[model samples]
Target: MYYIVGMHIHIVPNRGSRPTILLRESYREGKKVKKRTMANLSHLPMHQVELLRAVFQGADLQPAGLG
Candidate 1:
C-alpha cells in the first residue's frame, strides 16, 4: 500500500546560525503524521526557494499582464 499525502517545504532552526530549508513529503499512518526529507534546498537562493514553496502551496502567481 503506497500512500503519501503531499510534499512541502520545511525549515529547521539552528542554535546559532542560519536554518536549513528542506523539501519534505508527508504521509499519515493510522493516527500519526510522518514526514520524510526529499531534498535539501538550503543552497538555493531565498527568492527561488520562496517560489518553490509557493508552488507547493498552490499559489497562483501569474504575470500581471500575461493573463
Candidate 2:
C-alpha cells in the first residue's frame, strides 16, 4: 500500500474488509538489502492523488467498475 504522509492512497490488498500492505521484500539485521530509490512524497499537499499515479503507472490497474 502506498501511504502519502499518513493518508492511504491505494488500498494495497484487501482481505474481507481490512486493508493490508504486503511487502514482497523484507529486511533483516546484519543483512544487506538492495535499496531502491524512494520518492519523497511527503512534501506534496495532494499526496493521495500523487501516490495513486505512482502505483498505477505503466500498469493496467483499475477499479472494478472503471473501464
Candidate 3:
C-alpha cells in the first residue's frame, strides 16, 4: 500500500545560546520513510546536516511564487 508523509521543520532560538532545530514528520498511513526517523539517527556524526540534506531531497521544493 502507498502512504503520504508530511514534513515539518522547526527553528528554536535561546537567549545567550545557539539556535536549536527540530524536524518532524507526519505519516498519513502506518508506513514511514526509514531515512526520516530523526530519533534513530540523531546520534550519528553531523546529524543535523544529514537531516537537512535528506529533507530537501525528500521534499519537492519549488520557487516561492510557483503554483
Candidate 4:
C-alpha cells in the first residue's frame, strides 16, 4: 500500500504571473517514492504561505483564509 510520509513545498514559475506555490504529499510505495499535490497556494500572500509552511512543518497553529 502507498502511504504518505511527509509534505513537500514547490515553487513553479510562470510567465506574466507570480510564481505558484504548491503543497504536495510524499508517498512511499515499496522502494519507490511518489508525490501528489495536496493544495495550490498560488493565490495566497507570502506571509500566509509562510504560516502554512509552518503548519506543514508540524506546527500546531492554523493559518487563516484557507477556505
Best by TM-score: 1
Candidate 2 off by > 4 Å: 1-31, 46-50, 53-60, 63-65
lDDT of each: 0.92, 0.42, 0.55, 0.83
Q: Tens digits of per-residue lDDT for model 2 on 1-67?
A: 4322222233244567644332232233354543222344433454454545556454466667888
Error of 2 at 9 (Å): 11
Supply every candidate's count of residue pairs whose N, Cα or C atoms clash at under 3 angstroms: 0, 0, 0, 0
Sorted on lDDT, best first, the list reads 1, 4, 3, 2
Candidate 2 TM-score versus the reference: 0.22
Candidate number with greatest lDDT: 1
Weakest ten-residue segment in model 1 by summed lDDT: 1-10
For residue 30, model 4's alpha carbon misses the true position, in angstroms, by 1.8
RMSD values, in order shown: 2.2, 11.6, 8.6, 5.3
Q: How do the residues 1-67 of candidate 3 rate in per-residue lDDT, one tens digit apiece?
A: 7666666554557699755555666665344344243433333355565656566568565657999
Who is ahead in TM-score, 1 or 2? Answer: 1
lDDT, candidate 1, 1-67, per-residue tens: 7775899999999999988999999999788999889999999998999999999999989976896
Stretches of candidate 4 exceeding 4 Å from the true structure = 1-4, 59-67
Over 4 Å off in model 1, which ranges? Answer: 1-4, 63-67
Say what the RMSD of model 4 is: 5.3
Better of 2 and 3 by lDDT: 3
